[model samples]
Target chain A: MKRITIITGHYGSGKTEFSINYALDLMQQGKKTALVDLDIANVYFRSRERQAFLEEAGIEVHSNIYHSDISADLPAIAPSIRKVLENHTYHTVIDAGGNETGAMILNQFARHFLEEEHDMLYVVNANRPETRTLEGAMYHYHRICDESGLRISGLINNTHMLRETEAADVLKGYQLCHEISEKEGIPLIYSCCTEEILIKLKETDAMPVDFNPYRIRLYMRPSWLDR
Target chain B: MSEKQLMKGNEAFAEAAIRGGCRLYFGYPITPQNEIPEYMSRELDKVGGAFVQAESELAAVNMAYGGALTGKNVFLSSSSPGIALMQEGFSFMASAEIPMVILNVMRGGPGVGGIQPGQADYRQATRGGGNGDYHIPVYGPASIQETVNIIYDAVTLADRYRNPVIILADGMLGQMMEPIILPEARETVTEEEIRIQKPWALLGHQDKKERTVVKSLRLQPDDLENHNNKMHEKYIEMMEELPQYESYRLEDAEVVFVSFGSMSRIVREAMDHLAEQGIKAGMIRPISLWPFPNKAFDEISPKTKMVISAELSIGQMMDDVKCAVCGRFPVELLYRTGGMVPTPLEVVEKTKALLEVTK
Candidate 1:
């Protein structure tokens, strides 16, 4: 894993969930971590919603400039984010919003990203209408890259239909990501699978050797919402 | 069945509208629901549909009116304040007897309220926001899949009744993602189909038997009364045939909750928790707001003690719940307004207190 990791994907592609899990994973590894939410495109369900929870777990969280007003859709980026970007002591994960429009906010930090060792992982959920196909995934991948001025360093297959996820859904996303990795020559960094689905995959040894499995807990959605 | 696809509520609603044969959309961007217009602008053209980001909500609703006048399926979506601005257009469309579908991805309300999930527009949508004597059939979907279904069917419902239809979703629904099997796209209505079905439409008069005039100005009092009476007839028919709701565990219950849209989901979770604690709780989720689904109230068990309206706003839907209860039971309001959402635990706690007090 790189010192700085940037996660970007379609709106409902589980980037926020993955970013939260990734940040916690880094913290568990005894690394000082920070999660910066740069998702101004969405009005709700951003990583910032979990600020207090993440901070309680020893992970520094940064998000909208107006911290008090959670509902405000202001585009004002906090100046403190630049501090975390410059500090090499902490491993940082930047959770960009959905699509190229969401990733556009990252353009302001392009110089810092260029100077740092970062892995920009394009999360792909095959169940999303926009990224279900290789052509569709590539279109967004290229568009996000163009808008953010950052090339994707890896692909993450994080597909699921919320609680309805099955092994077939994960494998379908893996297939799409595999095709994209082969075509773009980008490494597939993670195959995010829920524990239950992972058990199902392991029953048949369906997962390939190269697919790095990343177990993700759905932190973005409340536990009460089964679907 | 086709593979289920994950989609945010806004984008899914937009896609469902397109598939529902809405070939023209006019909207102005606002928080939360902006994705509807964004999706429409990006995908509508590819499907041979037209999308216009109008100058304002008023302009967007007017554009929808203009498109619907030609007997084309038109879609319009906006948030709270934006919907408020489009009230005049809504009133005009209702008076003019135009058929179109409007989506209110509601947020905190009254003025330019916060950009968070809110159901304060319950009265605005179910009652009237514009001028006198109009009722738009409003469907409050609880989930993304339900939202898609309602939006898809709303296209036909609007056209069938020759009146505007409203799909009331909140920011939570607009931003949330869920798996949905989208219905097969409805074949777009051909020009010939339009001519045959909507003979009253104002297509070019050159080839028509009579010059068509679509206007709301019935200057004569009797004529206006007759026009209103005709429109009220459709509302009556909608009340009779279109009132839909879900009754969950109402067979034997001490307390019943009446909620709609996203708030109902939270209430459902609370019901489960209440059940664990030996508190018998039930729910009536109104899928249609305007028709009010008063029949569901009759299904409440005789054992039920009190009815509660749980909402994300300050007791807006409680009025309808009270009307439906009709003095048969005491109705109370449990709400979190100004962008605050009550957690399941909060709801459970409130229900317990309410039960104790009533006991």
Candidate 2:
């Protein structure tokens, strides 16, 4: 794992959820962690909405420049993001917006990323309409790289249908990610699975032996929503 | 049916519209519902459909009107204030009996409210925002899947009645993600088929030697009255045939709650918590806001002591709830306005407090 981990994917691809989980995991491992939200395209369900909760858990959250109302969807980027990028002691996670348009904001910070030891991971959810196939996945993967001016270091298969995800779904996503990795020469870094789905996958022994799995919580969705 | 896939609500509505045979979409971008137009611009062309981002909400609605006048299925979507701007066009379409589908992914507002989820447009949608005494059939879906299903069917429903149909969703519904099995695509109707099916359509006058004039203006007072009566008859038929609602845990419920769209989903969770405490609470979720499903209220358990209207707006939907209850039970309002959403625990606590007072 590199000091700076950048997460990008299609809208509703679980990038925000994965970024939060990855940042917390680093914090739990006794590293100083900071999560920066660079999503200006979406007005709702961004990682910044959980700022107080994340800050309470000892993970510094840097988002809107004004630090205004969370509901205010301004395009301003916070300057503190630069501070986190400059500091070497902290393990930083950048949650970029969805698609090429969302990742376009990263171009402003391209120089810093180029100079630093960083890993840009493209999250893939096969259930999303845009990335269901190898061609579709490759299209988005290339578009994000082109727009962000940053090459993707690896792919993370985080496929799901929210709470309806089964072991078959994760395995199906793995197949797609494997094909992408084989075709592009990029590594399959992680296969994210919810705790329940992870247990099911283990019981069936469906995942590959070398498969790297990341556990995530659905923090964006409220508990009241059953599915 | 295709396999279930996760989709954001706005994108799902756009996909469902295309699958329902809508070949024309005209809309301006507005948050939380911007994905509708964004998806249409990218994907509509692949399916032999056309998408136009009009200069303003005013232009978007008129463009949809012109498109629908040609007998093509037309779709439009906007947020609260944008929908307000399109009211005049809606009135014209309603009076002209134009078939089209409109979506209101509402946000907080009397003016330019915050860009968060809100149901403040309930009165504007259910009642008339446009001039004249016209009522458009309004469908309030609680989930993304339900929104898709309603949008799919609304395309045909609009054509059948020759009136614009509205799908009422809040910012929460437009922004949330859920698993949905999309409906199969409908065969694109040929131009020749449309000409035959919609004889009143203004395609071209050269072939028939007669022109179809689509307008809302009636010069004579009697003529306007007759036209108004005809529209009223159609609304009566809608009330009789199109009212839809879901009654959850109503059997022997001591307190009944009424809500719709995103707010109802939160109220549902509150009901479960109340049940755990040995409190028998139930809900009447109105899926159709226009032909407001008053029938659902009749089935409320006689033991129900009070009826509460839970909403993201301050007592907007309560007016309709009061009419539905018809003084059979005491009615109350529980709400948070201007983009503030009441949590399930808040609803649970409110229900208990009301129950205590009634007891």
Candidate 3:
């Protein structure tokens, strides 16, 4: 079973940062990694940069611009999708667009690939659109499942906003995602982690999956990091 | 391998669903297609599968939606009106990019028009029927064997593309019986294997690492435009790679006839009559409506003198043929409506008339 992890969330959610770090982490863990830019819907924290960087780090990348002024002229990327699924050997992580509309491109491209066996993970920032409340999150989930023809397998609570985010918000988002999980018939797979927040969230009940920063550390770590 | 047994087109679809790994069936009884759901109700239980006589076509499609959510190979059967009721759900299914098959045993349209066969819904099936710019891979099978084969292909294509696939057959195909050799079922990947492999699905977490979402809402114009561009890309990809059609005696022919579904059968008979009369003619049938072999018509336009499109509708496929020919050659339509099919004699007469006018 070749595993392809897709890291997605609403606009302004920290899905891109988490995606970059996660792909590098998997690579550090001795796995082949491929990161795809599925964010044709948003540009604030685009994934195309990660495409070149990931490739430089010996990871494959899929970045096709399907949304642009010359939109109708864009060649369909099914052949590329087929190639990636057929040839890949490592974990592939697609950084889908902000909303379901944007993410639908990936779903359309990989529709054949999303069978009963595939895993689709939704990144939830409690502050994001259509996900502020449990009911809102469930609405987004149902809509996404219906549009993409891909069943969502789990959720990743990544509630955050620049430096304004606190450990408490992550836990709150986790709980909200958990409530929505009952409606969607899936679970929150993991929660985003930060150094200060991880220590603060340690006492919290929501299980947080440690986002691997080792691969990024090998290339370029954040200015604040002391390795 | 016993000899191919004669079976109704609807029964062929039912049997094909079983052979194609469709383990779940959800449908409400409708005229012409009732036998399909009835057959499924009886056989699904014996095969350790799930079958539900949904409260209505609306419920049936949604239940199939539930079955599809479970990553099960699922199917739903309905007639024209019932299919109309399923449009809302189909739009959702199309937007979600779920891979499933829908068997539309088409009857007359607008309301509960008639129990008789009609291709009037050709426009509705090819065009997006619900709110949203969505498309389903539509296949019009002309025979019982094609009914089974198209169902088999529809499931595989839907699963392969992760989009809903429609098997568009009229009441003639659904109610009529013919001999067919059913194919053996192929081994498919299990849902658990899919769960393990495609980590983007909405399955509950096995290992908590990050949250994933599935959505299609793009609030901004640029964002939405980009999403639409992506869909166009998918359509182009299907056009170039998956255009499905069958052409007979097209080479070195002066007159070419275009038809689909049951009308194609009549076209074939007409072509045969033309052949016996020593009047050179050919025929082309489109099995897939979305990818619509427009390029095929374009390729042969220069060589052909006259092209006639015969359909069960006023002229649904004529739009496609006209678009393809681009007035490179003379294009004409031989159409019938109100659920009544034109016979081979009628089609032959139209073909002769077209040839005379153009030549």
Candidate 4:
């Protein structure tokens, strides 16, 4: 069965970037991968908008929109989803909209996995709305869980600054993940590290890392790179 | 086992947990059920187990999630409000088929009611207290011995089906101490055994084997329907496999008294009163409320005329009794909530009234 991975997070939590890069890496490794843009919250900067970038790299990119006029109604995309699950043999990466309002698309697709088709990852940035505090992140966790009928299997910490990202910020993100992993009962599966910086953040905690199949290539248990 | 012991319900639960071979307990202390965590803190070290008063109920339940995922005999304890906070994790445990035990030494609620014993949580416990379409097997023990036995069995049942099990007691059961026999300790699997047993549990997939993802996400309509159907099938199987009941002269009685947990003890005493009054009353106390003893009443309804359900809530389990009896027999409910424990005399009076109405 094709592995389905859902990437979701609070607003401005780098879910799109992570999803795009992860899908790119998976495809590069000869894994048949597809990226679905389910980001309904942010109108612009959606990974869906960069379909050409993915398709040109010999990958598949599907937008979450079914009808241009009725994009928000999740039921509209069910038939297309049914086709994909039935016909496609690709590593399906679902880039969910940020926050609770955007992740509502999950409910529409809920009927698809009667046999448990996918694993959900709740991407987090200690800096995002409703995720700044531990309590706030928990509330969002419950909200998505209650609404989507899906328990977050793992977490992705993309706590960083767009231009002024630092190693300290990355470590802070790991601390938050550590606290969440202890409390939520799910492991901190991985954190995204880009090629723009060196591995300056020490692995002070047990939460693992995902190198997004880029510059980092060592598949060590602590910081495993997909490539 | 000695005679009645002067112990609190929470302390009894803690002792019962130890007797049940519970090696890991994660909890955040709330009123009424705080003694459970306190006792665990004191006792876990002696048993070479681990206990943590988590940052919050959220963390405690999640830690329970990890422990359950690891397939260890684990438990998490809390009161009503705390259980409410852990509902999401509970649902996750249920769906993921994570086997673990939970003890809700219930206190009054509707949003932090009081630290008093209240059966008002009946709805939340019996129904889906957690989100989604799932049910957790619930066991209500009437006495401290029953608490020990049920906690032990909760662990067994949870692992047996790979689902979460809850022991729903009240403040009275948690705080009150009666004569109890601690069972002989059984061998439980270690963390290494856990890693060996469930290779699918997210223990950092170093095996380079096919990644076994344990998630409850069903995105397709047909697939979701199939999942629900499978869950229903398991529930049906549970109904056939796990229904338990205790009968007090039910074979020859005219009216059957239905109650559970602490309330059934009162009904037991009430049955004695009814016997002296020359009333043919028997009690049907359900030990497992979810896989409800539906068949028990089906077999008993033909022999009995009326069923009187005495509960702490208005009539949560009464509906189950009615459904179980196929709605052919008349079922009446008698209850007192908000930390009220009905006396034996009160139950006898209510049983008499129910008999009159059925007649």
| Poorest lDDT segment (10 consecutive residues) of candidate 3 chain B | B1-10
Give the whole-model CA lDDT for all candidates, comma-separated: 0.89, 0.90, 0.71, 0.72
Model 2's CAPRI class is: medium
Cα error of candidate 4 at position B314, Å: 0.6
For residue B333, give model 2's deviation from the true position in Å.
0.6
Per-residue lDDT of candidate 2, residues A57-91 (tens digit): 89999988865365776889988899899888889
TM-scores of the candidates are 0.97, 0.98, 0.58, 0.58
Candidate 4, residues B144-190: lDDT per residue as tens digits?
77788788777677777778888889876775433344566666566
The most accurate candidate by lDDT is 2
Model 1: which docking level applies?
A: medium
Across residues B240-358, which tens digit of lDDT does each residue of candidate 2 receive?
Answer: 99999999989999889998988898898888899999988899999999899998999987788999999888898899999999999999889988888888999999888887887
Q: How well is candidate 1 docked (DockQ)?
A: 0.76
Interface DockQ of candidate 2: 0.77
Tell me how far the alpha carbon of residue B354 in candidate 1 is from the true structure, in angstroms, after superposition.
0.9
> Which residue pairs show collisions in model 1?
none
The residue-by-residue lDDT of candidate 1 on B13-46, one tens digit each, is 9999999999999989999898899889999899
| Single-chain TM-score of chain A, each candidate | 0.97, 0.96, 0.78, 0.80
In model 4, what lDDT does residue B246 have? 79
Position A190, candidate 1: lDDT: 91
C-alpha RMSD for every candidate = 1.5, 1.2, 26.1, 24.5
Model 1 residue runs over 4 Å out of place are: A114-116, B207-209
